[model samples]
Target: MRPDPQETAPAKKQRRYWHRTDWLSLFSGLLFIGIGVRYLVEPPPNTGVMVLTLVFGLGFAGFFAVVSRAFRKR
Candidate 1:
């Protein structure tokens, strides 16, 4: 069957707002990694500095990964 020319507009994909969030996530992750490394190397005594750094590093890295995936095309 022949389709009508007037009804044949190509579908347009919706744009996402992931670019800004992606960069923010990446930067935050790197910062966390740096802080984590620093804390791990010279952690404060009687405090959970090392544990906190590790948690921040892991969480930020995971968030960055998800954001990067979302904005892969950008």
Candidate 2:
């Protein structure tokens, strides 16, 4: 089929810059890892610290999972 000789197709859209967004993810991952490592090095004497350590460790694991998926898609 041949038609619409005078019609034009739409132009492609340009993606916005996102390099700065990478820093946020990096900082969050690092922060969680740091807290986890700190807890590993010095066992928390208090129950609150123990709970925080477990949460941050889980957070670090979750961060890696998300980052890996994002990188794979990219």
Candidate 3:
């Protein structure tokens, strides 16, 4: 005889630690903060410099994310 569907137990969801870290949001927030700080400076930074800094920040954030994921996997 077939078992009743309602009698079946629900599957438990697998939890992941990485889900807690919103990397995109973190990166965007940092970018906004940097732009705000740039405005606060007496002499506005050169556009090239600002772009370079943002690129560097992105690289750092990416590296951090990779390291975090690796550690979390352990």
Best-fitting candidate, measured by TM-score?
A: 3
Write down the lDDT of every candidate, Cα atoms only: 0.68, 0.68, 0.79
- Using alpha carbons, what is the TM-score of model 1? 0.38
lDDT of 2 at 54: 61
Model 2 Cα lDDT, one tens digit per residue, 1-74: 77675566566689897543454466567766876787699865687876786677667766876787788688
| Collision pairs in model 2 | none
Off by over 4 Å in 2: 1-44
Error of 1 at 34 (Å): 5.2
Report the backbone clash tally of model 3: 0
* Model 2 collision count: 0
Give a tens-digit lDDT track for model 3, residues 16-59.
Answer: 75546856469868887978887797588788988888888888
Candidate 2 lDDT: 0.68
CA error at residue 49 for candidate 1, angstroms? 1.0
Least well predicted 10-residue stretch by lDDT in candidate 3: 16-25
Candidate 1, RMSD to the unseen true structure: 10.4
Lowest lDDT 10-residue stretch of candidate 1: 17-26
